[model samples]
Target chain A: MTNPTAAMLVIGDEILSGRTRDSNMHHLARELTLRGIDLRESRVVSDDHDGIVAAVRALAAAHDHVFTSGGIGPTHDDITAEAVAAAMDTPIGVRDDARGILAAHYEARGVELNAARLRMARIPDGATLIDNPVSAAPGFSLRNVHVMAGVPRIFEAMLAGLLPSIPGGRPVLSQSVRVERGEGDVAEPLADLAKAHPALSIGSYPFSENGVTGTNIVIRGAEGAEIEAALVQLSERFGA
Target chain B: MTNPTAAMLVIGDEILSGRTRDSNMHHLARELTLRGIDLRESRVVSDDHDGIVAAVRALAAAHDHVFTSGGIGPTHDDITAEAVAAAMDTPIGVRDDARGILAAHYEARGVELNAARLRMARIPDGATLIDNPVSAAPGFSLRNVHVMAGVPRIFEAMLAGLLPSIPGGRPVLSQSVRVERGEGDVAEPLADLAKAHPALSIGSYPFSENGVTGTNIVIRGAEGAEIEAALVQLSERFGA
Candidate 1:
């Protein structure tokens, strides 16, 4: 069976502006890959309404699952929840379950849930909440879209709570062979190996470090034995 | 002047499969932001022809400038140049100018320009070359789209040669205030600050380290003095 396809939308201005480097995309990519989901495409957009709304619609329609990170916090710049609702043409309100979760956590800490804090309880219609064990404000899953917080810790927590319910196929297996030569010396053999193994993908990446040039040949496929078989032929060709 | 809007397309399977973490997106994002070019969106697609072609077409049309990284090598998986040509409805061939450069470089090194090696000389019609100083395989710019190598060093070399020619606007200025408290403590004041500073963008990011919760408040805008002015109020409000 084919792996369930997935896409990610990382929304934030800080990530685009160079103030913060986004780690969630890589995290989600690794997680989804391990779960046997084919992460086909990923997009990063600013916190603007049009960009967010358009990306959500496009990715949700194209893939089986869509994961979004960032722009889901409790500040004015956090417009992900509203923009997501707009994308799905749904009405969002202060969800009772969400409010109860946040209210209980805040009351126990002797902190009042003000208007800005209460905004965290705003959930899109027909969506279920994804637990955020790190913080009280929960993320939500609207149809195929899973909207999570931008913070690394909170996003991971939400994903752990959400991944088990989603279906996946066999995980794609990969192996790499390093060769002490430039790409020019390795391209011909690598291309020939690719022709031999029609089901596998062979990638040649050249690297130069401190005046030393080398190439890394990676073999990827769904079957572990097939990738290892390809690696054997590649190792004999390059003497890696 | 408004910042020139740009989008990026990163083509590779390793990134999508999580075999390799993508650093070029962050590198390009930082560079574009510093040059006053608004990098509005970025995409990552596998080494498939249709995916690359569709992304190149869509991003090129939507933004003022488009940048793509990866799939410009000599192996079988290296198909970005052909895909890009398809996207713009242009023909691709081994151009004489590119061939001459590659021939000279290879001849000097006593290397033969075989079919596999010569494939690197293929260039889309009506495109000017972007020089790669690190390696001899040059990148190309077709209209508003700039296609460069995937390697970090080579991509940076090509970008260093290309960024000077592109027009830019006033760089966006930024400053940050870190508070040793959770986002709930800062959301209200941060929202009020965001409302007051209409021209500036205020972002709050939460972090937890060894059981200590902290929030980082960032202020960004094109005006340096206005950002500095906003920072003073934020520091006073958060007592940072």
Candidate 2:
């Protein structure tokens, strides 16, 4: 069976404006890969409501699962919830369950659950809340879209909780053969190897270190034997 | 005046497959911001030809400029040139100028310019070459889209050469005030400050360290004086 396909939508002006470097997409990509989910695409959009809505709708339609990070904080710029709800064509409002979670979290810390903070409790209709052990505000899963916090720790925690419940296919296995030669020298053989093993994904990532250019040929497949065979063939052809 | 909007299209399977952590987007974001070009959105697509074509077309149409990285290498997986050309409705072939550049560089280093190596000379019709100081193969600019190499060093070098030619508006300026308070405690007043300075972009980035949560309020604007004034108001309100 094919692995479930997923896409990520990262929403934040801080990223677009070059103030913050986004790490959630990378983390999610690695985790999804390990969980046997094929992460096909990822996007970063500024904190624009219409942009977020359009991206959400498009990604949700294209892939089996849509994961979003950022813009769910207790601030004026946190418009992701409303935009995502609008995209899903679901009405959204402050829910009692979500509010209760935030209330209890803040109450213990002597922090007032102000209106701005309460905005985090708003949830879309028919959506299930994703627990955020790192913070009080809960993320939500409406349909196949899983909305999570943009903060790295919180996003990681939420994804850990969410992925276990979803069914996954065989985990993708990968092997790499490093060649001490320019990619051009290996391109033809690599192409042939790729064509011969159609089931495996063969990628040549080139790197230059200390004025020496080399290529790392990575072969990935669901089957361990197939990946191992391809690696051996690649190693033989490149003498790596 | 509004800055010219730009979007980035990162084409590579390595990134989507979780084999590579993309630093080009962050580098491009910072460069675009410094050059006064507003980077509105960025997308990472796998090495699928159709996906690259579609993303290039969409981003090229929506923004004033579109920057692409990856899939421009001398390997079978390097399909970005053809894909971009197809998206732009242009013909592509190995051009003499690009071929000459690559041939000279390889010949001087005692490396044979084989067919696979010569593939780097493929240039789309009516596209201007962007010099690659790090390597011999050149990037191209067809219409508003600038297709560059994916390697960090090459991408940075190409961008450094390209940015000077593109006309830019006033550079966006930024100032940040760190507050040792949760975002919810400052969201309301921050919203007011953001509203007060309509031209400035106020962003609240929260961080937690040593069990203490604090927010960094970054104020960005074209005018330094405006940002300074907004920073003063923010400090007065928060006493930070």
Which one is best on lDDT? 2
TM-scores, each model vs. reference: 0.95, 0.98
Q: Chain B TM-score of all predictions, in order? A: 0.97, 0.98
Each model's lDDT comes to: 0.90, 0.93
Query: How well is each residue in A1-240 modelled by candidate 2, as lDDT tens digits?
Result: 788999999999889877889999999889989989999999999989999999999999999999999999999989999999999999999999999999999999899999999999999999999999988799999999999999999999999999998888788999888898999999999999989998988899898888778989888898899888887887788666
DockQ of 2: 0.88
* Residue-wise C-alpha lDDT for candidate 1, range B50-71, written one tens digit per residue: 9999999999999999999999
lDDT of 1 at A48: 96
DockQ of each: 0.72, 0.88
| Candidate 1 Cα outliers beyond 4 Å, as residue runs | B210-212, B235-240
Docking class of 1: medium
lDDT digits (tens) for residues A134-179 of candidate 1 = 7779999999999999989889989999999899888878788878
